[model samples]
Target chain A: MLNEKEKHRYSRHLLLDKVGLQGQEKLKAAKVLVIGAGGLGCPVLLYLTAAGVGTIGIIDFDLVDETNLQRQILFSINDIGKNKALAAKHHLEQQNPYITIKAFAEKLTSKNALELVQQFDVIVDGTDNFSTRYLVNDACVITEKPLVYGSIYKFEGQVSVFNYNNGPSYRCLFPEPPKAGSVPNCSQIGVIGVLPGLIGTQQANETLKIILEIGTVLSGKLLIYDALSGNSTSINIKRSEEQIDKTKAMKPHFASFNYDAFCGIDLINTIDITELKELLKSENIQVVDVREEWEQPRINELNALIAPLDDLDDFVNQIDRNKKVVMVCQRGARSLQAILHLKKEYGFNNLINLEGGLLNWK
Target chain B: MKINVIYFGMIAEAIGKNVETLQINSIQPNTDDLTTFFIQQYPVLKNKSFKIAVNQQMATNNTVINENDEIALLPPFAGG
Candidate 1:
């Protein structure tokens, strides 16, 4: 029922024949949960709030920083150091008095992602990292909620509506995460502030359309927008049951799943001297020497295979597949490289690097 | 066969060009073939992941590439 004040509030929307009183009611009945209060999140939250969405949940653990001012329009100098979600909620509540805003100032982890996603009809992904992006996608897929996805690079942006009515998930677009450090983030790199604004508004549009059931949904489609080129193109993506089922299978162990390790982000599994000694005594573990033959003071008792870092390709066959492989080098850097290379190129999950190499291996 | 390869995002930055016409040796090269050639030219891309689109259609590694087709290489963006 549109009260007199409510009708005055959304008069523009009501003016549209397509979005008459019925669509206004649908908007008021809709529940949208936006993840992240950063660049894309700011716009998505702004529009959804202004449109009189009945309930909006904003979950962002990030604090409002001075650097975020160029884009994250929801925060200002006074709001700096405040949690983005709470700050966004405060401002958005004032924007539209008719709506309810729920703010969660916590990181979205596997343990909590599913529960939060289930509360909303549409999930908007505005996170700035692969780990959280994948987490949001998996949670949306498992909970069967439509996801309005948007990501921005320096001058380019990508927007898609994923997991809408059995459409393709993000995994169907890129099943495996790119090796960490290979792709730089917005901080490491830089993004045009307006890029996210452009992409985020599109995401907000998608969310409204999904709720209003007007126009075609962006399911199974990936939209690419170039700020510099001034062009928008979309690639047709097919729903991969394999990708969807892999995510579904993880439902049982979702809480235990480590998205950081899956994305090769900050997986630090180095064996110390004591642990190395114990593992060596346990037998059948392969200790790989990534140092060059001439670079090391050899250990007569360790019997470590000398596969230099530069020549690792030649010794790939000799590396044991089923057994544990420990990589060692002069310092710690080369061994870490060996482990990362072996893991990325050869899928050797059994390899562990020895920290500080043999520097203190007396 | 001569085909136009369009690069997007970081890939375009690494390649230093948005579009290029390359003459490939194989008559019917798949997306993998282009990937191999690019990796050989720019080893920086050897580790970075990107997806190929043939004439605006998402393509797999085995998806065949034909002459005079527009192939787009788009990398995943990690920004909001």
Candidate 2:
């Protein structure tokens, strides 16, 4: 039952036949957990609060960066260094006094994913990495929670509903993650400022529809939006039996699943830019640039060998096995793949991938 | 068979074009064959991973492609 203030607050929602008094009550009763307080999360959080979603939980360990100001409208210049989840909650509560906003300023790991996700009726994925996406999907499968998924690139975005009423999960659509380094993130590439705003609102709409039981949800379908072309395409996704079986097999032990290992993100052989800079001044170390010759903004400080990844075989013999070899690429991805190749093919264990690659070298 | 292929996001950047029409001899070409043909045509896409969509439907490698089919190459984006 809406109180006097609540009735006046949601007057617009109360007028709708689809989302009348009963639907408004449902919105006030639903608990949605949103992961990542970045681009998509900002708008999703904003609209959800305005729509009167009762218990909204935000889990993001990231702090507000200067780069986030473009799309993350929840923060201003004053909230620059503050934690994203906390900042978002602080602002959202001010937006709607009738709703409850919970902020968890912690990373969602394999151990805590299920525990945190199980408390919510629905999960909204706003993360920007493959590992967290896979983890969130598997956790939702285990906990049997509906997931509202959205992703953005330069001028395009994808929105889908996964594991809704036992619908096709993310793994059913994308059985396996693309090989590491093959696909670059938004940071590596770049996104238009308004792309996330468009996509995030769609995600928030899906969440509201799910809660109100109105409209056709995006289950078993992918919504592809090209902001540049103003084209929207919907592709039907069929659930994979094999993937469902695999997910079922791990349901009992889902907590123990190592998503990072499953995604093959080798964190052991990575060296940050600062460490790489320090290593360059030391002896018995060779830096190898694995990027193609045509790739731009070459690293000039290091007298590194120009061994393009495709032609690494030709230059493999030139690298001394005795000296520690550090691999470099435009971004850190190619270098990690190079390290894996060198280790597997030539048995070169003395290699390290420069984290964030030459992009972060400065 | 001639198929209309569309590329999106990074896949388009690597292919240097958003859309193309490919002529293949196979009467009923599977996604695997289309992938091989595309990679052979655009060597830059050899290392990239993308999904194939046929006629606005997500398709598996075993899914068949016919003449005048609309196919799209979609790369997963991790951006928020």
Candidate 3:
């Protein structure tokens, strides 16, 4: 099945003993689905496309914003404001015409996840939130497909292969999602742009290995790469039947399972930054910033009171009870936690969360 | 006993260090006890969720820790 152009296109891969003519054929027959065309998704899509994977599917509802150019290398300034999956498809198609790339410009909801993942041989999770990540893992587990997982935070990244050859799933490692406000994302903190490239490349390599059956798969193993330290550490994990069964039990209700609630994407009283800006001009609202003092993008226009979430006890007496308090943090989750905490622990009822925090103020 | 313990992702930020030489005052402490010890030392760690790895292997609450073993406090990173 080697057309002249196909063989010439994959000449480099054809030369490798591990990925020769037969391996190239296998790759051409493999179908891989990538979720989230964001930071990690960029490199994974690029490399996988270049490697001549026969069919690739990308599903991301996000748009190609200017902020994505730093890490999402698929989109240029011309492609800004475009759907990420469609924009990625446009570039990847030019990279390798020998392959087929499918773009789904829709969000991966609970309803679509199971059916969509069932079509792919391997699922690559480059999503940025706990809810989607958990949803992807459960779908892969229920569908019995391998998932190549990668995540980045600041200068570090984590990579692992779950549900491969009956290995451990994500739940087997972290059975429960972290408290919603406890973990700050790249938007809240920041990420070294190159970090996801490294991690995503590793994920691409794993996908190729899985397809070619050449090397040791990263099943039941988690790889932690620290760009700052230039060191990679491995942690061995065991498959938990209980965790696997828990996911399988949801197979009947897979379409209706509320992953958002599972990950605590909660329903809390929130006001957007623009609304808060408008409110400050009219009413006397008390603004309390819940982020650490060291966090960036500080908004001084509100003349907000600084009360870090960790040490809120110190500022208990300072927060006015009579005033309508607006809680804020780097991304708003921590501020929501602050409101819930103050409301529950101290019986304060007049608290509201600042949606999306200071990061979205601009 | 003092052991080499490493922290990852947000856990490191909470502890204010990537790695540390932690001194355990308990006799043959389990993973649960070590976690409690850490929460007591760094109250900030009580916010983030993480798991423990003993010498490159995942540890359960009942997993025992020995002297000179490498320990890693790993957290699930939510970034891409």
Best DockQ goes to which candidate? 1
Q: What DockQ do you compute for every candidate structure?
A: 0.70, 0.65, 0.67
Q: Give the residue spans of candidate 3 off by over 4 A.
A: A268-362
User: lDDT (0-100) at residue B71 of candidate 1?
Assistant: 90
Q: lDDT tens string, model 2, A252-328? A: 54555556655656554788888987887876689899998888777788788999999988997787667778899
Ranking by lDDT: 3, 1, 2
For each candidate in the order shown, give its overall lDDT on alpha carbons: 0.89, 0.87, 0.89
RMSD in Å for model 1:
6.6
Which 10-residue window in model 3 chain A sums to the lowest lDDT? A341-350
lDDT (Cα, 0-100) at B64 in candidate 3: 90
lDDT for A121 (candidate 1): 96
lDDT of 3 by residue, A1-362 (tens): 76999999899999999999999999999999999999999999999999999999999999988887888888899998999999999999999998999999999987899889989999999999998998899999999999999999999999999999989999999988887777888888888889999999999999999999999999989999999989999999999998898788778656655566566565557899888988899899899998888898887788989999999979977887677789988888999888777653444556788887889677
In the order shown, what is each candidate's alpha-carbon RMSD? 6.6, 10.8, 12.0
Candidate 1 vs 2: which has more DockQ: 1
Can you rank all candidates by DockQ, best first?
1, 3, 2
Candidate 1: clashing residue pairs, number: 0
